[model samples]
Target: MKTDRIMWGIVLLFIGGVLLLENFNIIEFYWGRVWRFWPIFLIIGGVNILFTKNKSQIAGIISIAILVITLGILFYKGQQPRQKEVTISSHTEESNDLDIPRDVTYSHPYTDSASVKTILNISGGGTSFDLKGSTDSLIIADVQRKLGNFSLETNKTDSITSVSFKMKGKSKWNMGEGGNDVDLKLNANPIWEVHMNMGAGEVDFDLSGFKVREFNFDGGAAALNIKFGDLLPITDVNIKTGVADVKINVPVASGCRIKTKTGLSSKDFTGFTKLEEGLYESPNYKTAVKKIFVNLDGGLSNFEVKRY
Candidate 1:
């Protein structure tokens, strides 16, 4: 019995130290994803409590149990080292009598929406309806709330026309958009053309796995990324910005004509090549057998055009 007491005492001491470290911020804890393995610790401690007649032994066992369980949870979450992940805090609710809706089958133009107007926010999320095989809809999203982790996702298999989505914010997201506007980030796992306006956001768009055609980019105090290697049967492309960094990726087959402009600042085309010549520049220009054109403009910060 005495030996058992000493054994439990050592376990208790170790657990106590772990608790202290946690309190001092030496380790972080996450109660979000992993709470499944917890019962094992409690069960062990409980079993020890039922068999151990000595008070000290039971106490030690319980303390050690708690410590092991706590640390296991912290370590399994990948948050132990402290890294930032893109996460959003948003709500989706259905409300009828919403603004309005119109369908466009031809080139008539149409629109759709999802908004919670009473939430005291200048922020909202919704999808722009598209024609299964053609482009006909124009998007106009006006959100005016302080935002963090804003994202827009469009269906990958559908066809659409002229997407003019915009975001405005009142903060600095390492990406900029003065204040009072929507912020945009797009990642579509399908093939489609995109025209986006990120008022102030850290916008990263990836088409590396799909096809793309006619893309336009506009940023206001933000970062922009458009990879052309992901686009197929390319038709045209353009990029414009107010204040931020821009990165464009194209393929060598992209014989597309491109134009770039910058604000009261210097431009960076270290990403692009063969500027002294024209579209039919040379065999090295890698013209995209298909007819295509690309135009680019930027204001303040860095701009780039490189092959993906």
Candidate 2:
């Protein structure tokens, strides 16, 4: 506890200094000035109590209160600025290189191949492919022939097609850190599949508003989170973890079934729907899983089936 308190003290002192510096011309990122001060309030008071003596009184308490109230207002006001809803239809063809289905609009696909997919001996820092605001396009990430960091993220206006990815991992000893962070938008509702493997590193994903056939997770030791974006529901999901935190979110009316060995039961997972044996419960259930399969592997945090 004492060690933790010292660490907190150091962190707060750093934040306060940064904020104080930013308040003047020392910094200029518009967000930096107003945003940096928040850490001071959050940490100082909490650390003061641990530091004892005159620590918890006067300026410390005042700073915490200011931080708390400022945060409350900032959040409340931030959410109030809702964008006007514009009608978006993907039914018509916007271009030849892309597919815009009746209920969706998409972007072009990627075509990269390798004879040895998994063992891509990367000698540089890392290669990156970022997908943004193509909410109706299906993305196929084939890591079955990939080596190196595979990082992917999508905002509220991105989507994928076919809903499947081909994934694979090298032999156990060859795996390393740094996988992918797939950010799902609150308004993303396209059906897609993901297949990727990680040697190491935390994989953070958001499933605020999404629909999919299933998820495939394999290998690695890390905590995973499957959380909702606000209050959202997703269906047709599957996951298997070696050793990590496993979470699942089930919405009312969406069909959910989890098939796993008893090993996944020990970790903390909320709202789990256990399936009975290898049973394919329905034509609906069978079709859902077949429609799209997203596979993920190895990350320190958040292995999720999302709703965005």
Candidate 3:
């Protein structure tokens, strides 16, 4: 009985840590998806109690192993990327309903300008989004949505260009007939500070061609695959994830340093030297002129960093 209680206590503490990270935007948990597996907890507890009553030590060990395997599968599934087909439709506002078009596609073309710094803010609720580098001199975007009022607002002041996207109103999370999606391609010439808040879904980000000064990403119940190609003199990258799998690829020549704080997550820093607990540095980190600093806080997620 004592052993069972201790095991349950440990389980509860693990769950509490995951929840705390979720609240801080370091992780996102969708109860609806995993609620069905709630019985697993009860089963584990029941098996543990049975072992205590019978004094079957092997049974207790088996129960714990089963629980671990189940949780591992759940984590693996959560990190898998999901694909959705979303088409771009013409924008038309008829009547006051803000009725969403079936193929509502908006393209913002790029025009050559003297802007040197780009500030981008991305906010979406339950939307699948894609981001990549653009060949044109101007930052371009093609946004498509099936429901809610989607807005792409931009501003420019001197050499700084600011762009923001939001799915306005409470209906942002409402997935109507076809679903919601945002596909963005931006010019990679200017220096950038990209801030992204993804409510849910999958994000595929490729920053290979852009000179990123600072990249901040916060996600909830999402899968992220990010590749960093080029970086600024002093690059700062901060990422927080919840109930997701995050994989980052760094350039071969760039010096990289990673610091992490995690809860119930597996971390793999391939080819990096572990200076100490929770600190990792690349081979050329000290000698390279350009450096990339990565700080990651994760909850109930899997994180991996690799050099390409």
Question: Which is the leading candidate under TM-score?
Answer: 3
**TM-score for every candidate vs. truth?**
0.41, 0.33, 0.69
Give the alpha carbon lDDT tens digit for every residue of 1-308 in model 3: 35676676667555555545654578565432442244566787777767777666676677667766777665544334334454324445442434353444444445545348879888775566677557564554555555566677778788888888767754323331334656677776778899988655556888887788888989765657788875567778898977566779888788999999977677878899999988999999999888889998987776788999
Give me the displacement of residue 172 in model 1, in angstroms. 10
Report the poorest 10 consecutive residues by lDDT, candidate 2. 119-128
Q: What is the C-alpha RMSD of each candidate to the true structure, in Å?
A: 18.6, 15.8, 8.0
TM-score, candidate number 3: 0.69
Name the best candidate (by lDDT): 3
lDDT of 2 by residue, 264-291 (tens): 1232223433345422222244434233
Question: Tens-digit lDDT track for model 1 on 80-173?
Answer: 4323332222432222312222111111123432110100011212211111222223222323332322333232122332232322222332
Candidate ranking (TM-score, best to worst): 3, 1, 2
Error of 3 at 107 (Å): 4.5
Q: What TM-score would candidate 2 get against the native?
A: 0.33
Decide which is better by lDDT, 1 or 3.
3
